[model samples]
Target: MLVLPKESRKLFKGPFGILHRDISTVLPELAGRTVYTVGDVVTHTLQKNGITPSIAVVDGQTMRSPCSRMPEFSGECIRVENPAGTITDDLVKALTYAINHTPVTIVVNGEEDLAVIPLVIAAPEAAVVLYGQPHKGIVLRTIDAGAKAAAQELLGLFVRVGA
Candidate 1:
């Protein structure tokens, strides 16, 4: 387990790719690339646009509140337990498994916000990881050596707990 510090918010400010107010605007860029959605809103937006992500990670909540029933996704469903403000070994394993399986939905028990870190780290080169920026818009991060390195560096700041 790893606890993220409040100060680490600065590291997450700049996205690895573009931030689009309209998710549809980035559809062309997602073509021919594996898409990994790290939030409920981002996944729902993509589905509404008729685009299914290769992997969707959701905790059935938005802004710490219950979401409108989980959306129906077409793929294998794997559930894992992850607490708020922290990442667990289970999440890392689930992300690794989901990336390998492809087209799977990871239903997290607690929160899925920080899942983007591991998603960026485990995603294949050229893959796109999408997540919502609260009331702002959607952030599209392209998985590359630089992005992976940055994610790893940020994750290193977390305080690791028991395995």
Candidate 2:
């Protein structure tokens, strides 16, 4: 749905939502909430900490390197091809399905970094979405009017190139 333009790369360098240095702190806030995770490390960390998010989006890579420990979820695994700087239609379909069907893991063939944008836009209100913040930590974004607007703004910054 959104494609990153070369000139706008700098805008996405940091986290789009609340940055939590410790994922544990965010875990307590996540109790009894629908959570969707994006990025391998973030998902693995959550699982290791005893929190199984409703959905996880992973690309088998972290920081552009092959992930040593790919997050494993025993649920419906949907695979889609989303290029490094773009969100594919197939991927959006998977995420849409995941919303109704909780406990889904989306395995991206290319990259899952940018998937957070569309996921946030499509996520139901009050849902929580988590993703890594590069060298910092995890970001906790709640799906609400403000968050959705922020995500939509970020996506808008990307050049819309597809029909």
Candidate 3:
């Protein structure tokens, strides 16, 4: 089970927690002490509310799109390596999978500036948000709009963990 604090969403890589049903052992702390996703929590919540969410994996897509390609920067003008395509088929595959699975919320951690678009279009009701870094682990950028508050909370949690 994964119990991720709402604030820690950014630092998390995949689902709040990836549990092996057979082994039944939790991994060591990945980041701060907080547990973002826990099966027990999810189970209780589901028993109380009757909800199950699928997991959506968010990957990156180049800014350029079909029929256009980002050139290998050797000189002044940027060139298109492949005019046939801009976005990769794998990205489409992942997105399509997400649509089919229909998880409760799609957590996006892609590098694109505005990843919320496709995710929103694909899963309109899903919670599309980004993650931030842990203060002690990385300096983290101020411009990361999604992770700011989470980072601050992570920092506080870190101090608590240290104490």
- Which of the numbered candidates is closest to the native, going by highest TM-score? 2
The number of residue pairs in model 1 that clash at the backbone is 0
lDDT of 3 by residue, 1-163 (tens): 1123446445534321122332122222222221111122222222233333242222222322221221111112111121111222333344446556543222223232222222333432313222211121111121233343443443333211111
Model 1 reaches what TM-score against the true structure? Answer: 0.93
RMSD, one per candidate, in order? 1.6, 1.3, 18.1
Determine which window of 10 residues in candidate 1 has minimal summed lDDT.
Answer: 9-18
Which run of 10 residues does model 2 get worst, by summed lDDT?
A: 154-163
Task: Estimate, for each residue in 126-160, the C-alpha lDDT of model 1 and write its tens digit.
Answer: 99999888787888999889999988988998998
Candidate 1 C-alpha error for residue 38, in Å: 0.7
| Model 2 lDDT, full chain set | 0.89
Give the clash total for candidate 2. Answer: 0
What is the C-alpha lDDT profile of model 2 across 1-163, one tens digit per residue?
A: 5688889988988888899999778988898888899999999998998888899999999999999978887489999988899988899899999988988999999999988888999999988999999889899998999989988888878776758
Q: What is the C-alpha local distance difference test score of each model?
A: 0.87, 0.89, 0.27
